[model samples]
Target chain A: MKKRTLISVPVIAALVAGVLFAQDITTWIKKTAGDKPALAVPDFRGAGDAQPLMAVFNATLYQDLSNSGLFEMKPKSTYPLNNPQQQGDIRPQDGKGLALADWASPPVNATHLVFGFATITNGVFAVYGNVDDTRQQTVQAAQLLSNRYLGSPVEADAIRKAHEFANDIIVKFGGSASLLDSHIYFTSSRGGAGGFGTEIWVMDWDGNNQKQLTHLGAQLAHLAISPDGSRLAFTSWPLAGGQPQIGMVNAETGRKIPFYNQQASLNSAATFTPDGMKLFYSSSASGTPQIYTSALDGQGFTRITSTRGNPTEPKVNPKNPNALLFVDGNPKEQIYRMNSEGSGMERVTNGEGEASNPAWHPDGQHFAYAWTRGYQAGEFNVFVADIAEPQKYEQLTHDGRNENPVWAPDGRYLAYMHTPLKSRNAQIYTMRADGKEIKPLTTQGINRYPVWGVK
Target chain B: MTSEFFRNRNLTLTATLLVAALFSGACGKKAPIPPPPAAPTATNTTPSSTNNTGTPGRPTATLTVAPARIERGGSVTLTWMTTNANDVSIDKGIGTVGSSGSQTLRPTDTITYTLTANGTNGSATATATVTIISPPPPVTPAVTRPNPMGTLESRLASDLKDAFFDYDSVNIRDDAHTVLVGNAAALRQIFMDFPNATVNVEGHCDERGSAEYNLGLGDRRASAARDVLVQLGVPEAKMKTISYGKERPQCTEATEACYQQNRRAHVSAGQ
Candidate 1:
C-alpha cells in the first residue's frame, strides 16, 4: 500500500498521453441484428482496504455496461490467466500479463477489452480505467480511451466512480445520454398501515440508496418525475380523506411545492411537459375526468378533452409536445392519442381487456403500456407498440400483473410493477426494453408507479 | 259485546300459558331449586317460574347503576341481572358481559347503557341512564356554517345511502335506483334544512384490476351516481365527486360479498 496525499484538485483530466484510434469513433455504425461487438470486463486489481471498494466498483461497472443494451459482454470464465494489474503490465513482451493476442484471438475472442485498477491512498480513493481495441494489431496502438476518477473512500462514491467510468465507455460506443446517473421515483406502501398508505420514494438507477421522499401518511399514486428532475408530481389523497389531488414536491429537498387544488373533486395522473414548465393531468372538474393542462403556477388552466366519458392519465410526448397519449373510456378503458389541444383523437387499443399506464419511448414514435387483451383476471402485461403500426405490437411480459411501464431515459430499459401469480405483494422491477434480463428492484415492500427521472 | 268477551278470554288464556311455561323451565332440576320471590312489576322484570312442557322461560334483564349522577369524568358501577339467559351484553361500548355482572365505567358524556339478554325462548332489554354533571366541552367543536343546521353535514353522511356498483361496471345497478331514490329524498330534506350542506360522492373499487385504471373506474362510478342524483333533483352544484379507487375499501375480505360492498359510491357530506 504505497500511500499518497489526498488530491484536492479537480478529478477530471483529459488523456495527456498519445491516445489514438485507427477508426472514426464518433460516427457509430448501425450494426445489424445479432452483430453486436463483444467486450470483456475483468475484475479490477486492488489491495488492503481498497479491496471491498473495488468489489463495489467492479460489480457496478460490469452491471452498467451489461445493461447498456449496446454490446454482448464476453463471459468472465473465458478470460486469460494473469490479467494486467496496472498500466505497466500491458507490454508486448512474451510473458507479460494481458497479451493482446490472448483476448484478440481464440477462446476469449473479444474485440474490445476494459480493465481497471483501484487503490486507496491516505484514505482517499482513485480508480484508473482504460478501454482497449484489441484488434489494433499492436498492443501499444490498442489503447482507445483512458481516464482516472477520484472520490471519497466510501461505497456510494465508489459506485459513483464506476458509473462515471461506465458512462465514458458508453459514450465511446456512440450511445446518447447514458442512464448511469439517473434516478427512479416510485410509490412505496412500506410505511403505511396494512400497506394501504403509500408515499413517494427515489432510488438510483440500479436500485441503490432507496429513500423516502414524502412523509405524508396518506395514499399516493401515479408518480411523474419532471423533465428537469427538480420536482415530482403525483396523485395524493388529502390527509383528511377526500378526493385525490395532483401534488408536487421539490425532488431534491422533499419540500412541498404548491400546485393548485383544482375545483374538481378528483385530480390525478399528473405528467410534466417536456419543457418542465407545465403539467398535464386528469381532472373531474367538469363532471367527468378529462385531460387538462396547467402551468406550474396553476395559471392558464385549460381543459383539453371533452369526451363525455372518463379520459385520464395524460402523458406528453417528449419529442412532439403537441402530441399526447391518454386513457379514454366509453366501451372500455383503452389507450388513445390526440393533439395537445384535444383534436384528432384516435384509439390506439381495441378489442379485449383494458389498457392503461401508457408511456412514451424517447424516440416518440413508439410507446409502451400495460394491456390485457382477451381478458382474464390479473392478465395485464406490458406491451410496446409503434404508432406507425399499432396492430403489430410486441408483448413483453408473459405472466403476472405488470403495469405502469415507464421507459428509461435512453429508451433501452423499462421499470414497472409486477406481482406474480399467488403473490400478495407487488414489487418494482426493471428490465431491458426488449423484456430480457428481468431484475427486481425492490422486494421489501409493495412498491409501484416507477417514474424514471432525468437530470 | 261477544267479540270483546272472547278477546278478554283470549288474554286470560295467554297469561295462564305464560306462567305454565316459566314453571316448566325449572322442572328439569332433580333437586329442584325453588323459584325466586316475585320480581317487581317492571317492564324488564320476569319472575322465575316453571311450566309442564319443560321449556326455558323468556329471558329477563334488569340493569341498574349506582351513583346515577356524578361529576364529569367520575366512575360508576353498572350492574345487570338476567334470568334464564345464556348471552348478555351491555351496549355503549361495554360489549359482552357475563349472564349477570357489574362493570365500573367512566363515561365523559351523559350516556345510557342498555343490557340485552338473549335466551332460547326470547330476548329482553333494560337500560340505565348515567348523567354527567357539567360535561366537558367536545374536543372538536361542531362544524358551523352560515346555515341553520350546524352539524347537518356529518348527519347527512348517515342519512344518505351509498350506491353499490357491479364488479367493474360503472352503470348504476337496478337496486341502486331504490337506494338513490331514498338518498335523493334525504338530500332534499337536508338541503331544506341547511342549504350550505354539500354532498361528496366517493367512488371505490374492489381489490382487483390495476390501481391506475381502477382510479378512473372509480371516478366514473362516482360521476354516475352524481348524475343519477342530479336527475333525482339533487342540485348538481350542491354535489361533487371523487374516486378513491381500490385504496379505501369498505370490506377487505377476498369474497364476492366483500367485493360487492367495496365497489360502491359512498355519498356523504362534503366540506
Candidate 2:
C-alpha cells in the first residue's frame, strides 16, 4: 500500500500540473515611423516536456518580429542573465532575476522587451506572453502588454499563435497590414521539365506550407491572385500549338472558373484591379498583345491600350484604380505606365537593359521591376523606382538573375525569384524594401513569379 | 487483490494511451494534409520497398488511352504510371508530369502519345495511340476519296519554306526575303488546290532570353513573316499568326546552330 501511494501521488500531481490558468489582456502602443524602437526578445521558457513545440514557437515568433521591419532587435549576447517567464517576472529586481534596468541600460539599450513562457499539458499548448517598456520607471508602468494564447499541441498552431502575437505587436507599433497569414502564389517547374511542366503553387509568406494550386499540364505564367484571395488568373494554352488564353480557377477549391475565349490567340499576363471586380490582361484578340480589361466573368471586354508593340504584364495601381502599368516592346522591352483609362501614357524606366515584370508598391507612386541595367549574358536584377520620378531609382540587387518582384502586403518587403550564379533553377526570395537581409524561401525545384496574396 | 489488479490495468492502459497521443501529436505540419489513400498512389511503392534491399532497379512505365478510337473533337483520357522513376513525362506538348496520373486530351488527328520515365538507374518509355475517326462525308456518290486535309497539309509542309531570323531581331533578312518569295508562290498554288484551307504562321524563338520576353519577340517574328508574305500578294484574311516562344524549340541543344534552327517562322496548315 505504501509503494502504491507513492506512485499515485506523482500521477495525481502530474494530472493537476496540466491544469493552467492565465488572464488574457492586450496593450496597444502607438509609435511613429521615426521611433524605430529597439526591441529585445528572449527565448520563451518551456514549462513541460514541450521542447520540440517550444523551439518552433520561439523561432517563429522571433522571425515574425524581425520580418516586421518596424523594430531594431538587440543581439542575444547582450541580454541579461535573468530572463522573465511571466508577467510577475518583469519586476524591479537586480541580483538573480530580470531587472528592467538591464534592458534600459547601455550595452542592451532595448526600448522595449518581449518576454514569455510556453507550456504543453496533455495535448493543449499555451503561451503566456508579455511586452514591457524598459524606459518606464516602475514595473506597472513598464508593463505594456500581457497576452495568453491557447491552441493545439502542433507545430502549425504554434506557428499561428506566434504570428498572432507578432501581428499584435506590429500593429501596436503602427505598421501596415501584416503578411504573416497571407500566402505567396508562384509558378514552379517541379512538376516536370521545360515550359509545359510549369504549374502554379502557393506557400505561406515565410515560405512554409507549400501546396500546388494548379495541374493544367501546360505552360503557365503570370500568376495573379484576386484581391480577395478567392480566385487565381494565369495564361495557358487551351489547345495544342494554339494561342495562349487567360485561365481562371477558384483559388480555394481549384475548380475551373468560366473565362471567355477570344477569337485571336496570344492572350496572356493577367492582373486584377484594386476592387477585383475586373481583370486587366494582354490579349492579341484584335491585333498585337495589348492591354485589355474584362469583368470577372469575362464580360464587357474593353481594350485599354492601342500600342503598336506587344504591351503585356498590366499591373493596376493598388491605391489608385485609374492608374495602370505594363511592359511593352517591339524588340527592346521597357516599363510603361498610363492611366487606367488608357490616357496620360508615360515611360517609367530609362537607361540600358530591358525592363520587365513591373509590380506596384503599396504606396501606388513607387513600383518594383526586373531590369538588365546594362548587364550582359541576359542577367537581370531587381529595382525599385518612383513612377513620377523615373530618374530617381534604386537598384536592389547587384548580381544574379533576380526578377519578378512582388511587394508584400506591408509594403516593407519584396518577394522575387532569384537564380544564383551557380544554380540553373530559380528560387523564391524575400528581402526588406531597402534590399537588406535577403532570405531564400524555397530551395527545391524551379520556382518563379511570386505574387503575394491579400490578407 | 482485485482492487490492486484493476489499478494496475488502468495505469498500463493510461501509459499506452499517452504514448499513442504523443506519436500522433508530432504531426504538426501546417500544410494541408493529403488524404490517406492519395499518399500511396503518388509514390511508387515497389521501388520504396526495394530500397530496403540496398539497390534500386531501372524505372518502368506504362501508358494507356481509354476509348482508343474516338470521333473528331471527342476527348480521350491518357493515363500513365511509372515505377522506380524520379521524373515522368508525356511527349507531344505534354512535358514533364507526375509519376502516376491521367489527363484528358482532345486530338484533332491520330497521335501516338509516348510517356517517358527516368530514374537514377535508367529510362523507359511507353506509347499509346489515339485514333481520330472522321464523320462519314455526306453520301454524294460512293467514291474512294483521300483525306483532303491530310494531303493538303503534307503538300503545304513540303512546298512552304521556313524563314530564319537573326538573334533578337524581327527585321526581315535578305535570306528570309528570298525564302518568303518562294513560299508566296507555293501558297498561291495551295490556296487554289484547297480553296477553303487557311495557313497558320507560327513564330518561334531561341532559348537565350526570358520566357516572357521571348514570347513577345516571337510574336513580332511571326507577324514580320506574315507581313512579308502579304507584300508578296498573299491574302491577309487567309493567314493567322501565333507565337510559340521558346516553349516549342526544334532543337534542345545549347549550340549556336541549334539556337538558329529554333529561331524561325514556319507556315503550317491551320486547323
Candidate 3:
C-alpha cells in the first residue's frame, strides 16, 4: 500500500503539471489579454488546371488573415478534411442549405469562416469570396473579387483577388471605410551611394507593387499623400545646398510642381485637410517654425499653432475640421492638440519618451506616434494612445527605430518606417492595430515617413 | 499517512503551477519568428548604411579664413583641413565635413570658429575667429538719400554690437541698450557715408521653433532690434528688417550653450 501511494503521488502530480501546461496554451489568446476572434480560410476550390493558381490564392488569403491583427486564425491542423465546393455546403442555420455554423464552430471554433471558389474562363481569371458567421450561420458579405483578362502571369491576378476579398472581410467586421485598394508613400535613398539624396517612393499597402515617385537629386525629408490621393506633398532642396521647401507631385501624370512661390517659405511636413481644399505645413518664413494652412492653391494663409519649440506635422482632425494635432519639443517632444485658431492647447501624451508624429485614426479619438526613450542611445518604437486618456498608451512596436506612423483609411492597420537599431537604412512596413501580422511594404533603401492613401 | 501524502502532492502541484504560470507570463514577444526572406532579394534597396570602419586613429585639424576681416555683408572663404580623422565638424552647424574643403561664409558680426575632428584613437580641435569690419565710410552717393552705415562706421572703429533677445521673445534685452546706441550712431553716419547702401537688420532665433515659425520670430526680433535704433534717432528709411528663423545658427551643438548664441538679431549689410 505504501509503494502504491508513492506511485500514485508521482503519477498524479505529473499529470496535473501536463494538463496545466496545455491549458496555458489554450488560453494563450483568451479574453483577458484580449481574445482575438477566430477566423478560418479554407483552400479555394477551382476548376481543372487551377491547382497552381489556387495555391497562390490560398497562400495569399492565409497570409492576409494571419496578419490582419484582428483574427485568431484556426490552425490548419484543426480544419475539416474536405473542402466545401458548392452552395449545398453552405447551410442556413439561421434557414437554407447545411448549417455551416454547426460545422465550422464545433471542431475549429471559428467565429468567422471565409470560403471561396475560382474559375478560368477564356483565359480570364475570376474569383469570388464569402464571409459566413459561424454562430448565426448567415452570409455576412459575398463579392466577386475580379473578372479580368489573364495576362501571362496568373499568379498576379490571384493576388488581386485575395487582396480584394480580405478587404471585403474587413468591411464585414465594420473596419476600414476606404475603398479596396491602397498604397503607402515613403522616402528612400537606395538608388545611389551613401551621400546621394533620398527621393520619394510608393508601394502597395500589403507590401507589393513598389515604385519610386520622385528623384529630387537632393535630400528628401517627409511626405504626405493628398486627400484625394492624386497628388503628393514633400520637402527637399531644389539644389544641392539650397533650403528645403515644400513641393507637390501628381500621382498619375508624374508632374512635379514646386510651390508657385518656390521660396515662399522654408517648409516641411505638409498635410492636406480632410476636404483636400486646404493644406497645412510648418514654415519658417515668419522666423520661427509655426503651423500654417493655406488653400489648395496656396492662398488664404492661416497660422494654426504658435507654441514655442516649433509645432510640426500639423494634422487636421478628419472628424473635426476645427481641431488640429501636432508635436512640440526642442529637445524632448510630446504630442499636443489645439483648435484651428490655435486655442485650447492640450497635451495628449505624458510621463516618458519624446512622442512625435501623431497619426489620427478615422475615429479621431485615438492616435498613433513614434516615441524615443530619451535623448540618449535608446531607439524608437511606435505607440498608439487615446487622446482622452494619456496614461492608457498601447505599445504597438517592441524593438526598432519605427517612426512616422500613418493610419490606413479603414482604421484597421498602420503603416510606418522601420529601421534596425543604429541603422540608417529604413524600410516601410504595415501591421494590424494589435501589433500582429506585420508585413513589409518596401524592401529597398533608407525609407522614412510612410503615409497610406487611396492612390 | 493519507494526510501526509495529500500535503506532499498538493505542494508539488502548487510549485509546478507557479513555474508554468511564470513561463506563460514571460512572453513579451511574438512566438515562432519566421525566417527572413532568402538573401539576394530582388530589392536590397537599403541606402546609407554608413558602414563605419570603426577603427580609431590619431587626428589633427586646421581651420582658417581668407582675409579674416571683411566689411559687413561681405563674403569670406573658409578653409579647413584634417588628417587621420573619421569625422569633422565646424562649430556653427557646418556639420560632419570632409578631410579638407572650403566654404564661402557670410557672417554679420565677428564669429569665433571651432573645428573638431574625431577618431577612435583620440580627437583634435582647432579654432579661428573672423572679424567683420565696417567699410571705410561708404562713399555717399547722396547726402540726402539717407544711408545707415558710413559716418556710423567712422565713429565706431569697433564692430557695432548686435542686440540680443530672450528665447521665443522679440523684446530686446536691457544689456543690449549700449550696443544699440552705437549701432544707431553708425547707421546715422551711413546716411552721410553711403546713401544707396541698405543696412538690413536680420532677426534670428535659436533652433527651437518650426523653421517657418522661427522665421516669423526672427523677423519680430529683428524688428524689435530695429525699434531701438529707430528710437535712438536713426531713420527707418536707412534700415530694413527680415528674419532667418533658426536656419543660420551661430553654434551647432545640441546644448543650451549653442542655442543661446543662435537667438540674436544680426546686422548684415544687404541691398
Candidate 4:
C-alpha cells in the first residue's frame, strides 16, 4: 500500500477569512439596523368610528412601545384620519395596492409599517395587526388576538397582553425595546377608602408588578429621588391630626425622617442637589409652593423664590448647579428656569399652553415637559426642547393625553404617562427623542410619575 | 559418635521446649487490670466547701459593690468578701478595682453596688446597703443677679413673672438687683441645710438675630449671672451656665409681644 500526503494552504486561508468576514457582517448588521429610520404609521383606516375596544388596544400598544425605548415612534394624532373621504373613494382593488406616494410623504417615512384591524365577531372583540416592511414590500410580522371585553376589570388584563404582543413585534422588527422592567411611583385611590389618602405605588413600566410603598392613608405626593438613588423625598399630609411635614426616606432601608414641620402646608417637590448637601423644594408653609433651599442636615433654610403663582417641581440641571427648571402655576401653568440663588428667573415656554412637570435630560442640554393644549376640552400632549435653544420645541405626543415625561439615563429614550379617554385608564409610554415610533410601556392601572434609574 | 549424637538430640529437645514456652508466654500475656478505687468518705470534703462558712447549705454569700458617691470630688474605696467562697468578685461600679480586691470610685452622684461569688457547688450574689445622705445646698451669694440685656430683661419679667433685668446691659440693674438680693438671702438659708448643692444658670434669647450670634449672646447672659454669684461669695465651682439661642420661644408669634416673652435667664438647683 502506498501512503500519500496532501496539503492545500490557499483553501485553509480562504475558509478562515470567510468565517471572519461573516462575523463582521453580523456585527455590522446589528449596529446599522438600529440606525435605520423608524417606520411611520400614517393612518388607521376606518378608525374614525373605532370601537372602544379598538381605541383601548391601539392606545395600549402605542404606550407600551413608547415606554420600551426601542423605537422612535411619531406621536399619535387623535384627529379623525385627515382624508377619511379618500378611504371610501378607493375601490376594492385599490385596497390591495400600496399607497407608496402617500406613505413616503412628509410625516410618513415608510421604513416600516404597522396596520391594525378590529371587528366584533360573535359578541367578542377580535383585534389583529400586520407589521410591514415598506422598504422590502412584504409583511414582516402579523398577530391575531381576541378578548371578551367583558365590562369588568379583567378586560384591562386582556388589553395589557395585547399591548405586550405589539411590543414583541416591534422588538422582532429591530426597533428600540420597551421598558417592561421599569416601575413607576404614583398616587392611587382605587378602594374608595375616603380622605386625600394618596398612597405611593410601584408597578412595571408596562403596568405589571404593582406594589404599594406607603400604607399610612396619608395624602402623600411630590415624590423625588436623590441623584445617588439612595433616598426619596416627599410630602405627607397631616397624620394623626398633627402638623403636615416634609419627609425623607432611605430608599434602601425604608427609614423615614421628617425634615420640616409646620401647622400649615409643608410639602412640595423636594429634590437633592447633585452633591446631596442641599435640598431644593417648594413649600406652602408661608402660603404657596415657594421654592426654598435648605442644608441636607435640616439647617440654614432660606426661601429662594417667591411669586404670586406657586413655583413647583424644581428640577436641578445635571450639568449646572446654579440652574433650575420648574413649573410656576395652574389654570395656565408655564415652565420657567432660574439660578440657584433665585436670580435670573426667566420664562422658558410661552403661555400658549399649560406646561407642567418639567424633567431635565441627563445631558443637561434638553428637557421634556407635559403641555396641556386645549386642556379644557381634554387635548394634551408632551413636548421636548433643547434648553440651549428653547425656542426650538418639538411636540412629542398627540394621543388623548400624555404627561409626566422622564428621561432615561442614555438620553436616547423617554418615558411618560398616557391616558386614553376611551379606556379612561392611564399607562406609561416611551418614544425617541425625535418623537417618532411612539409605543406603550405599561398597561395596568393609572401609572404615573416614572423615574428612570441611574445607570 | 554415640556421645555426640546424644548431646545433639538433648540440645534439640531443650531448644524445642524453650520455643514452646516462649510462644505460650507471648499468647498468655494480657493488658493489666486497673485497681479498684477506694470509696469516698465524709471526712474528704471539697476544699471550697471547707473554706466557705457564711451559712452551711447556703451558697457562699456575694457582696454587690455600689457605684461610688464623691465627697467634694474625692475618691471613695469599697471592698467586699464572701465567706467560704472559692472565687469572689466585686462589681466595681464606676471605678476599676486594684489587685488587692478593693475599688476607689469617684462619681458625680451616690451610686448603689453589688457583688458576686462562686464556690465548687455554684454561685451567689449580695447587694451593698446604700444610704444616700445628700449634701447641703450651696449658698447663693449676696451679690445681685445680672440683668438680661436688650429685650431679654422685659421678656424674662413677662415670661418668668419673678425674674427681671436691665436694658442693653447684662449687669444686674439696681431694681432687679434688689429682687435678686432678697432671693439670694433665702437661698443662703437653704444652703446652710445642704452645703454641696449646685446651680445651673440658663440663658435665652429672642428671635431677632442669627442663631449662632444669639447663642453667644445667651452665653454672655448666663456667665454674667454666674459672675454675680461668684463675687457675692458663692463658690465658683457650684455654678454652671447654659445658653439656648432663640430655640424655645415663649410665644409662637412674630410680634414684639412674643419676642419680648422669649428672652430671659433663670437658675435651677441640683443636689
Specify the highest-TM-score model's number: 1
Q: In candidate 1, how many Å is residue A16 off?
A: 50
In model 2 chain A, where is the ten-residue run with the lowest total lDDT?
A21-30
True contacts kept of each: 0.55, 0.28, 0.04, 0.00
Q: At residue A310, what lDDT does model 4 achieve? A: 50
Candidate 4 residue-wise lDDT, A1-455, digit = tens:
11111113432343355344433322332342245445444333322233555555666766655444455575444111332122223222222234433443445554545554555544444444555544443222212222222222234643664565665665675544344443455555432134435556655544456666666556554567777656667755442222235677765444675575433323456777877778887655564447788887456778777675556678888877877887764234578777777766667787775676788877566688877655532245777766655565667677637777787554656777676767645566766665755767556554545666441
- Which is superior by lDDT, 3 or 4? 3
Write one digit per residue (lDDT tens) for candidate 1, span B180-248: 999989888888888777878889999777676688789989888989999999899988787899878
Model 3, range A118-204, lDDT digits (tens) per residue?
A: 777777676766666666624433222222223322887787677667766655564546435777777777652236467777777
CAPRI classification of candidate 4: incorrect
Candidate 4 lDDT at A327 equals: 72
Docking class of 2: incorrect
User: In model 1, what lDDT does residue A184 have?
Assistant: 91
Pairs with backbone N, CA or C atoms under 3 Å apart (clashes), candidate 1: B20-B51, B22-B49, B22-B50, B23-B49, B23-B50, B23-B51, B24-B50, B24-B51
DockQ of 4: 0.00
Tens-place lDDT per residue, model 2, A132-209, is: 998898998888788988998888888899998988888777778878778898888777445456788888888888
- State which candidate, 1 or 2, has the greater DockQ: 1
Q: Give the CA lDDT, 0 to 100, for residue A400 in model 3.
A: 43
DockQ of each candidate relative to the true complex: 0.32, 0.21, 0.03, 0.00
